[model samples]
Target: MLFRQLFDAESSTYTYLIADHTTKAAVLVDPVLEQVERDLKLLKELGLILHYCLETHVHADHVTGTDRLRQATSCSGIVPDRAHVACADRHIKDGETLHLGDITITAIATPGHTDSHMAYLVNDDRVLTGDALFIRGCGRTDFQSGDAGTLYDSVTKHLFTLPDETLVYPAHDYRGHTVSTIGEEKRWNSRFAERDGRGANRLRHRPSFIEFMNHLNLPDPKKIMEAVPANEMCGHLAATA
Candidate 1:
């Protein structure tokens, strides 16, 4: 199996490229529209066939490259089940798996960043945490049908149950952190875990987490206006209303 992480500077987004070396079949997860050409060139140079473009959710931070990639290659555009992407070629549900030869990508429903978000577990080892759980922080729950309490439950009940050593690859990272382990995040992610007075990290109470999230007062993403609509159409600007 071959796994590569590609970054889009403009949106601070990370697109993933996962493929099976033996079959040369590849899938791009959470791709950004601006980086489509770079992604295509990489696939071509690697002698791989683009099989699918999988979106974690309908993004507000940046438009997806699925439509452009679908036009360039015979790839299907796949989105999370129930996501408002009417143009997607497929909708993947929780526990559903997509195979690229030996590579296994299983979807785990982890909403709250949006009403329908998914984190992909690759081969049961590494997790591609779209936007639900970031390295030190988590996604905001102030918009797009987001709920702070729901995000807390998804992270603690669903994501935190995975193996402690499972690799955490988030969709976006502004702190230059590329990857982390589940154990590390559980122990150190300030948004989910608070430091005790004695210097130990403890799981933050749900009420505290929710309260803090609700009062963040963060600004909306600059691209939200255009990005959301375009993403809903699978990145087809012309089709966006």
Candidate 2:
């Protein structure tokens, strides 16, 4: 398996190119619009054909390049079944697996950041966490049907159960920390550490949604409204042009 992790400094977003070296087939995860040209250029240089473009969620940050890339390269755009994005060629459900040459990617429905959010588990060991889990902190549950207790459950019940060594690659991070292991985050994350009890008790005592959002300090995603609709429609502007 060959992988390239690309970073956009402006939004602190990371896009991934996971490929099978033998087949020269690749898939992109959570791509940013501004980095589309660079991403496509690199793919061309690498002698690889893009098989799919995947989104973890409908982003509130930068516009997704999935539509433009799909039109440019004729690649399929894959997103969660619950996502209302029109550009998605395939709507994947939890436990659904996608084949990219020799590699297999599984979709895990991890709703907290947004109701339709997903986390892609790649090759069993690596996960594209989207905005759900950051290196040290988890995503804020204050917007777009975001709930603190739901987020807590998703983290402790769904994600934390993965192997301790599972590599966690998040979508954005303002801090320089690029990546971490499930075990590392499980032990060190302050939010999870403070939550007491299990199941009902955990949910009952969870922090207020407002309080949690306040601490997150997340800036409004640049041009979100413009970006989202365009992205959902598979780069409508780029497609038309």
- Candidate 1, residues 1-241: lDDT per residue as tens digits? 9999999999999999999999999999998888989999999999999999999888999988899899999799999999988989999999999999999999999998889999999999999999999998899998999999999999999999999999999999999999999999999999999888999889999999999999999999999999998998999993333
- Total backbone clashes of model 1? 0
The alpha-carbon lDDT assigned to residue 79 of candidate 2 equals 88
TM agreement with the true structure for every prediction: 0.97, 0.89
Model 2: CA > 4 A from native: 195-219, 237-241
List lDDT for all candidates, in order.
Answer: 0.94, 0.82
Clashes (backbone N, CA, C under 3 Å), per candidate, total 0, 1
